[model samples]
Target: MLLGSPTVTREAAVWRRRLGGNPFTVAPYALSCRAAFRAHRGSFDARWRRLQQLAPLLSSTAAEEGGSLRFVPEAPTCCQAHVYLRGDAAALDAARDAVLRERGVRVYSRLRGAAVGPEADECYFELTLGPRHLEVADAVYVGAWRAFFAALAGPQPGGRKGVGDAEPQS
Candidate 1:
């Protein structure tokens, strides 16, 4: 389900990176994704509830209260965010692997993308939620998180280096 109210999609930059006006447009992206999710009715509604319930379970392990892991905005071009979860290095690594093995957010289908393993202590995964099956009042995040948590149940790849510094993994 949508985390909360929708953010504003303004003509100008909602947040200024240079000036340091952060935390803008977050609501709009979430709302847009929620809106898209709401269109499908039956499937979307169920999925949304599942996603909302599961997100906290996965995020419970987050290390930092606000950093080191979090969710990303479905919209907005200026800022990038992810639903972060904190744990030991090993735990994060395993979470990364679990996502890849499952081919979804936490364990199964949530958004429309893939999850890759970690670079090291830093883990990077991409979630590209589409316009279909989205809405403003609510959205699905748990399905994606399921795939994310599953990755943690294994080992990191040998050749995979710089996971944290690498580009988005979807």
Candidate 2:
């Protein structure tokens, strides 16, 4: 089911039509959802609790970056944490690539709706603490983010100024 404001739902429908047709041929089996939830309720609850605990820590860590990065919602109520990085898009992309290539963790870089525009030199990425993450310590994730921001702030190979070194755009 599509959940959104009327305008958003209408736009989604328009895109759906433009794309040819609805992706799902058959509606999802409701009983399967019920069965899965029942079977994995404990795991789901644990992940939810972990996410709740991690959000504040991640927010505080982002706060320490001195304004280069920030959590979008400030307080997220879901499993995924959305972070907005204010800097050159290319540099942001490089940093994201470096983090995934070097650290073996994936942080998705995609922002929709009002988050993107010609006026802002910023990028939004998502970090999620999934089931595999539950096996690791929280400090690992925090440290990885710190390293990513540092990479964004540090000098590039071709002597390009990092976001922290560049003059702030008006």
- Quick one: best TM-score, which candidate? 2
Off by over 4 Å in 1: 1-40, 62-68, 72-82, 85-95, 98-170
Can you give the lDDT of residue 97 in candidate 2? 68
Q: Give me the overall lDDT of model 2.
A: 0.65
Tens digits of lDDT, candidate 2, 1-170? 67999999999899878886654632356557777768766676567668777777766776685435565566656666666667666766666666776687544554432336333766666766556768868877787676677667686567644444555589
Residue-level lDDT for 70 in candidate 2: 60
lDDT of each: 0.41, 0.65
Stretches of candidate 2 above 4 Å error? Answer: 2-24, 27-41, 109-119, 156-170
**Native-referenced Cα lDDT, model 1:** 0.41
- How do the residues 1-170 of candidate 1 rate in per-residue lDDT, one tens digit apiece? 32433453341344344455445645677778777557644554444544454344446533222224444432223222244334455556555555554444333222222243242334344433333424422223444344344343332346333223344579
